[model samples]
Target: MTETVAVVGGTGTLGAPVVRHLLDRGASVFVLSRNATNVPAGAEHRRVDLASGEGLGAALAGATVVVDTANSNKGAEDVLVAGTRRLLEAGAAAGVGHHLAISIIGIDQVPMKYYRAKLAQEAAIESGPIPFSILRASQFHQLLDMALSAAARFGVRPTGAAKVQPIDPDVVAARLADAALAGPAGRLSEIAGPKVQTLSELSRTWAAARGKRRLPLPVPSWGKMGKAVAAGALCNPAATTAGKDFEEWLRHE
Candidate 1:
């Protein structure tokens, strides 16, 4: 039987590639989001609000698998944790067989607020009725690029001794698409970039990529979150690494 996959937040960076890959695999795809605009071609769009649980039922209907790439930084608790609960409830009601979600690596060890909410979201899915698969990925190259760009506007690139193994979102999207088709395997191996480099090094590489010549200002990793990052909590050495390194991605961009 052909798989019917519903990609929540399918208009976003990682989600868009997931929708495309699923379509390439011959699965019927639906992009569920609050805004119907910018929906990927070859896939249907369904407007659904995760915070309010509005339109979830209709969006999830006839879906054999639901890949949740939806995330909110501003309203983490309301949108990620609570919203995941809502998605699970709706998925269960719709007879969805598999629930796959993308999560950050070391969310358990990291004391960041967003990471805490994501950990809770994972808990909600684990305790829910549906079978699920969770893929924890390292930070994306785009995330670091955006952060560095914002910092550059202030005329200083502040980077601590923290190490980061940034993965490409397209690689993550491909893994998610494969997992959606493979059925729920539960807590798949984490994925990361091939190279683990310090934030300082990455900052320099990014600056060079953009045709700028600025040395990264060394900042101290003071707090618990910073300590965790400095201790390499976010870099999983044993993870299945398959993606473009930060430099490679920068070249393509």
Candidate 2:
């Protein structure tokens, strides 16, 4: 039997690749989002709003699995935690067998507000009605690049002393696709980059790869969040590691 998968936020960075992988795996794919303009070519686009819970039940109908990659930095509480609860409610009503979500590693250890929201989102999924799988991954190489690029515009790259193990989102997306196919297994093994490096080192490598000479300013992390980052709370050495590191990913970008 053919499996039907619904990918929420399917046009975003990690979500886009997940749609491609699910398509590659021959699953019937639906990209559920508020705006369908950028939805991938092969998958069907369904207009749905996670925040409002509009169109969710209809959009998720007939789906065997739902992969929630939806995220909102500005509205983390409304869109991530509450939206996840809304998604789970709709998924349950639709008789969706598996609810799969992508989360960050060490959300529990990190005291950041966004991580707290994500942790709440995970809690929602765990306590929800449907069987679920959650894949906790490290920071994405793209996220680090975005941070470095933003600081580069100011003439210097400011980096914290925090250590990060950034993984390629494409690799993370593939793992998500596999999990969507593998059924609900609860929390899966975490995923991270092959090597763990400090933010300053990642900045230096990023600058070198782009052939730009920029001064890397060292910034100290303070408070609980900073201490957690410095303690490598974002990295998982025992987790599965795959794909390009920061330098290799920069080469392609």
Candidate 3:
């Protein structure tokens, strides 16, 4: 019998691909999300909310690994931290072996509210008794696109108070799946794109893609600690980071 993998937050962007990759690798997958109806055809879906501690224990049963991609904008504590606690506790009771979490780079230095939440989430997964790997990633190209799209609507494509090393989500999913197959490496290596570009350049890229020229205002306090790319908060693009660049991702998409 093949191993079974559970993808927490499987409904999210990255989580969906992780599920598909696991299935392609001959592993049976359980997709845990609030909406069970939309889970892919081959996978079994369960309705569970990690925030309320609802149905988590039952959903986690009989799994070999749990790939956690769950997050909420509310804060790190309420969703990432608390949901992880519920899942880890349940995974332990259910005899789950490995735990994998998707995280972000520059979480420590940026002091961004969301990144702080990410850091806290990482800490929770690490301190849990389960063997785990926290894969920290750069801003995904899709994330960049969304950010740019939101900015373009306002006709203000702001230039850099910060930089982003954007990676494709396909590469991110593949790396996460590979780690799952290898079991736990405690805390594994971080993931980043090949190039480093500022958000201004990102806006230009998006604007050009749309057949228009645009510029964004450099807004302060875009997010917590968002003003300090000189601090290299999002500038570390180690070759070991893993993943393709935004241009490449756009080509493939």
Candidate 1: count the clashes: 0
Candidate 1 local lDDT, residue 43: 98
Ranking of candidates on TM-score, top first = 1, 2, 3
Candidate 3 global lDDT: 0.80
CA lDDT of each prediction against the hidden true structure: 0.91, 0.91, 0.80
Q: What digit string (tens of lDDT, one per residue) describes model 1 on residues 53-91?
A: 999999998999999999789988988999999999999
Runs with alpha carbons beyond 4 Å of true place in candidate 1: none
| Model 3 Cα shift for residue 209 (angstroms) | 0.5
Model 3 steric clash pairs: 157-216, 158-216, 158-217
Question: CA shift at 73, candidate 3, in angstroms?
Answer: 1.3
Candidate 2: regions farther than 4 A off:
none
**lDDT for residue 84 in candidate 2, whole number 0-100:** 95
State candidate 2's TM-score.
0.97
Regarding lDDT, does 1 or 3 come out ahead?
1
